[model samples]
Target: MSGYLMSPRQFSALKTGLFLLCLVPLANLVYGLLSDTLGANPIEALTRGLGDWTLRFLLITLAVTPLRRLSGLNWLLKLRRMLGLFTFFYALLHFASYVWLDQFFDWAAIWKDIVKRPFITVGFASLLLLTPLAATSTNAMIKRLGGRRWQLLHRAVYAIGLFAVLHYWWMVKKDITQPAIYAVLLTLLLGLRVYWMLRRAGAR
Candidate 1:
């Protein structure tokens, strides 16, 4: 294999490792439940934990392109789809926790919360946007959609990321430190992409 690429076996190994690594957060949460270590507000802890992992995976998915460009590691692109799928998986879990555990399947109350709560509104919107992305993540869908259209659809991730940050920020009423950090990191990531676009346009 070239320096910029990985051998097939190595790639398979790395992909498996990453898949398992991504499950660690979920595993830890499960362990906490079994051990009764989630404290007084276990449901809230579980819901927030899944949501945090969802945002983290989303940010990590966004970072793949930058990392690949910076490190000249084209293999990183191979991992991106998997990372994106994981992001959606955790996002689904997060939403499920809220709808089931937190809201107790109360559709009327859920609708009310979504309508009245800014954070819930954005969080729901984020999940709605992620649904199509997750559904069409397959190679077959990409082939059917064609590369250009698929790329356009996937660009919604940027908006999803923005909504996710807003969801986190607005949900926290006190000690906005963590949400503020997420905001700064997301700004830098999106800003880097903007800078690159202008640079390319200037070169052209």
Candidate 2:
């Protein structure tokens, strides 16, 4: 498959297919919500589900760089932006569910919870970091910020990844298996970044 070379049109079609594939799980969540099939506590289920997808998509988006470098498939970079945006999309839904369904737009209560709950605090911080990345994802912003500065700003995704994993690890009471897996992947991704940075510095 490494030898397989797709034309530009084929590459575009492949990307469309992958994007639709990513949407299936999110669509299932919506279907589940509409049918009232979100387990015992609907709010908890929705929150967990969206949070899970957010982390999953984050991991997927992070994996793109390593995968592209290792596999020599430059096309992977094309999907990263869409995947990152989807991560933010699910995160927004997760936040909305918490504010609307759990806290009912109670600012005071939300503020109190953020201070008291480490998981919530980490999650909120991660979302805050993601906001600017999402906002500046356009070509105009890239041109305005310039490539180097834009790249530096987007590196906040690393911090977002850390906070996300911490949020998951802190939130889970007894079952730590899933969070641990995400932690391992996050570690690998960050480690790769460190390795690349050091290699580039050495080359200089």
**Most accurate candidate by TM-score:** 1
**What is the lDDT for 48 in model 1?**
98
Whole-model Cα lDDT per candidate?
A: 0.93, 0.93
Q: After superposition, how far is residue 60 of candidate 1 from its true place, in Å?
A: 0.2
Give candidate 2's root-mean-square deviation (CA, Å).
Answer: 2.1
The residue-by-residue lDDT of candidate 2 on 39-97, one tens digit each, is: 88988888889999999999999999998988998778878889989999999999998
Tell me the lDDT of model 1 at 107. Answer: 97
The clash numbers for all candidates, in the given order, read: 0, 0
Q: Which stretches of candidate 1 lie over 4 Å from their true place?
A: 1-3
Query: Every model's Cα RMSD, please?
Result: 1.1, 2.1
Worst 10 residues of 1 by lDDT: 1-10
